[model samples]
Target chain A: MTFANAGTLGALPGRRDELVAHLTRPSTALAEVGCLLYEVGVSEEHPDTVFVVELWTSAEAHRASLELPEVQESIAAARPLLSGEFGGFRFDVVGSPLRGGA
Target chain B: MTFANAGTLGALPGRRDELVAHLTRPSTALAEVGCLLYEVGVSEEHPDTVFVVELWTSAEAHRASLELPEVQESIAAARPLLSGEFGGFRFDVVGSPLRGGA
Candidate 1:
């Protein structure tokens, strides 16, 4: 089953674009670590929020990715721009019409 | 840009799988309306919650889908099983390495 991590991160005041840029930076190592999808989004209603959705080969793979140096560095770089407000949830993907039973 | 809608729906008690089944019921009409990805998931922490993530070609495409008979029918069928508790957010996808700038 594909493990999914979906959530929102709040950027300090008008720093949302900066946070998003850091998030979208190419991290080729993610694919080797079993990340199938990594998406970043911004909402008009929540100007300061950066939404992220990720799909991994398994929950273990998702967890392991956090330990990768590239991942760790990215997190460190993004920490300063964050407002400490976060919301998220995790799940095992049951199905996806496009992906056929993710 | 891809428009993303990601959220959770609470099921009435143990009816989560049922709700997930309905949600994953292969709505081919969705693709016709510019739906790119539609995923359903369940979390171990929240047994009664069904998480959904969707990617549409545009926000307008997503709204148009809500009026489709197939979509309306599915919503009506699933309504009775819902707990009326929903948590979701919508955003315009600015970038995705896998999809190349979604």
Candidate 2:
């Protein structure tokens, strides 16, 4: 099964663009062992918020990615720019169009 | 540009499996004018809830798909099985690994 996560993040007032740049750079997540999809998008309804859609080969791979130096560094840097609590949804992906079928 | 929408839905008691089957059967979304990715997942942390991650060729295409008869029918069918309100997040995708470097 595909492993997925949907997270909503809000930037501090006036730090939206800078936060988006840091989050969307994306090199660290993609280079991980089980990385499948890592996408960053800015919400149309809220310019100061960001949405992250992630897919990994397995849940373990995803957890492991957090240990990488780049991932850790990025998180620390983006921490203060964050506004509130992160709303994260984790799922066991039963299917998707990207994989051709569910 | 990739137009994306993320929505969270809660399933009524004991209807998780049935709801998942109906949502992931996915033929109608794929056949739509600009549908790109439509993924439905069940949250591991909350089995009774569902998350839908969608990608379309354009915002208009996504709105148009909603007008299709099949889509309307599915929405109607899934309505009763749904619990609380749908929390939808709209976004403009800037990059993704699925698109080979976003």
Candidate 3:
């Protein structure tokens, strides 16, 4: 019963590359921390939007990572390129039927 | 450039109430720790699956909240009632165009 915090992001036109690059930038310090995963890429149905996925040990860990200078800097760098609204919800993984092959 | 960590979850049948109740249960300590928001409901299109949305001060805050005994116990309680898979993505809020009323 792991809790997962998740959300989707909308990117500005022609700025997908910039967004991805900013997210995937070198992060030696972030890696040293307990950040489980941080991936950013373009959406298949909506190319103008980039999908970001991250897995953290806990909500606290996720919040702490945000306070880091590196994370803040990366976000600032990626800001200008966004166009549309970006928001998402967070939920705990109560169960995963896919584990049984659904 | 606020980074929003978000995701969606699927709940078990006839258990939406249970899921929501589990998430919204009274907590004296959790509320004191700066866990921003935790909400659970059903999907409009997919009623069989419950929808969960949370807004935390930061990813770390969301993760740390999970470490609390209350969160853990709630998760364990809700586990058996779930049916399908639950997962989501996290993204940085580069910009929100809706601010202009879209």
Candidate 4:
């Protein structure tokens, strides 16, 4: 089963854009087989609130990605800029038009 | 600008699948032009957690959908099954393989 994870990040005041840039770094690590999509987004209602949504091939694959050095380093780099609140939730992709038919 | 929305819903004990069914009703309202993808997913770690990831032509279109009778009714119907923790965030889709060239 493919895995879709979404999370809420509270960026330190005025550092939201910088945090986005940090996540936007070209992830050479994404070349790993399971990473389908990993994109960052800013909330329309709250600028300091950001979303990290990922589409991976499976649960195990996603778990593996977390162990990769790139994922570990990214977390370290993002810690200080974070307002200290980071929450993420995962979802199983049950339907999608991107597959040509929902 | 296209809008992508993702949300987390906590299901009342043992009511997760029920809530999913309510959300899965063939949404005729989805035929609306701006409504692209409206998918429901369950988390691998927590069965009680659900995700609603939506794609709309614009934020305004999504706002409009909320006013539709169908959308309003769904909200009402699903309320009882929800654990009362309804939170969603919107994201700007910067890249996607779905568009053929990320």
Candidate 5:
């Protein structure tokens, strides 16, 4: 089973671009730490907000990446630029119709 | 700004409690069309895989709650109990430092 971590980064008005840059910078770093995919993009409807999607090998691997100083720093940097709330959850990929040939 | 739609419904092995009761029965009919605060409590580290979060007020009210044919027959009856690849994305909350305070 693969692991997925999904969430939203609610950015403050005028800070969306800056926040995206911050996240993308260390998100690149996250990609190097066995994080399979890291994507940062803006919403089509809500331009001020940003969405983040990540796929990692395992929950432990995802947690391990957070331990990296770069990851921590990037999050800290985003604190001030955010607006409403940043919330999401992690999951385990137990099945996939496409991949599993269901 | 205050729109967020997150995703991850990759379930297959053993069918994950019958696809979370067929997506919580229309996600409770996509929560009366306006679509806010719909929750499905059924994921903890990939225990067969299911995670969905939605907060909607726009994007044409979550695309008019999917044109409400009983939410498209509950996503076509969860497409054969799912596995892998159910992605997620949607957002527009411009600023929220705890609801625009910061």
Candidate 6:
């Protein structure tokens, strides 16, 4: 079953753009490790928040990715830019009309 | 450019499953309107919440979806099951490593 982690991360003050830059950095490593999709987004209505929607092969894969050196380094790099305010939910994808062969 | 809307909808207590059922119903109409993905998810940690991550060809496409009779009907069916609490954000997708032809 596909696992999903979708949420908002609040950037510290005006550091949203920097945080976005850090997150949007290409990571071949992620796809190599069971990430089907890792989407990052931002809304003008909530200037300090960065939205993320990830589709992983499984919950375990998502957890394992966090331990990767590249991912760890990425998290460390973005930690300072975050406000520690996070909101969202993780779920096991029930289904999609798209067939999701993608 | 892809437009993304990722968020959580609060379902009335014990009605989450029904809400999910309503959302996961097959909708060929959505794809015709430029919906790339409309994923529905649920978490044990947040049993009352349904997580959704939508990818549209553009923000306009997403807005247009809401006006569809099928979509409006879906919303109406799900509304009574909801608690009226919504959390999430919308943004124009910057890019994805997947090449996103998917």
Winner by TM-score between candidate 6 and candidate 4: 6
Q: Is candidate 4 or candidate 6 better by lDDT?
A: 6
Candidate structures ordered by lDDT, highest first? 1, 6, 2, 4, 5, 3
Candidate 2: clashing pairs of residues: B96-B102
What would the per-residue lDDT of candidate 2 be over residues B1-102, giving only the tens digit for each residue?
778877788899888877877777747455457887778888767878888877789888988988988778888998889897577677887775444543
Report the CA-based lDDT of candidate 4 relative to the real structure: 0.75
> Which candidate has the highest TM-score of all?
1
Sorted into a CAPRI-style docking class, model 6 comes out as acceptable
Question: Residue B51 of model 5: what lDDT?
Answer: 74
What local lDDT score does residue B49 receive in model 3, on the 0 to 100 scale? 63
Candidate 5 displacement at residue A62 in angstroms = 1.1
Name the weakest run of 10 consecutive residues (lDDT summed) in model 3 chain A: A93-102
* lDDT by residue (tens digit), candidate 4, A1-102: 777877888999999877877777776676465887666667657878767777888888888988988779988988889998877677787754333332
- Give the per-residue Cα lDDT of candidate 1 at B71: 89
What lDDT tens digits, residue by residue, belong to model 2 across residues A48-88? 78788777887888889888887798889999999985776
After superposition, the stretches of candidate 6 with alpha carbons farther than 4 Å from their true spots are A100-102, B97-102
How far does residue B32 in candidate 2 sit from its true spot (Å)? 3.9
lDDT of 1 by residue, A1-102 (tens): 888888999999999999988888877788898999899999888999999988899999999999999889889999999999999888999997665443
DockQ of each: 0.57, 0.48, 0.05, 0.30, 0.09, 0.47
TM-score list, all predictions: 0.95, 0.87, 0.50, 0.76, 0.57, 0.89
Pairing residues by index, what is the TM-score of model 2? 0.87
Winner on TM-score between 5 and 6 is 6
For candidate 6, what's the TM-score of chain A, rounded to 2 decimals? Answer: 0.94
TM-score of 6: 0.89
DockQ (0 to 1) for model 3: 0.05
lDDT of 3 by residue, A67-86 (tens): 88987976787789877578
Tens digit per residue, CA lDDT, model 1, B1-102:
789888999999989999988888866789999998888999888999999988899999999999999889889999999999999888899997565443
Instruction: Provide the lDDT at A53 for model 4.
Output: 77
Window of ten residues with lowest summed lDDT in model 1 chain A: A93-102
How many Å off is the CA of B90 in candidate 2?
1.7
TM-score: which is higher, 2 or 6?
A: 6
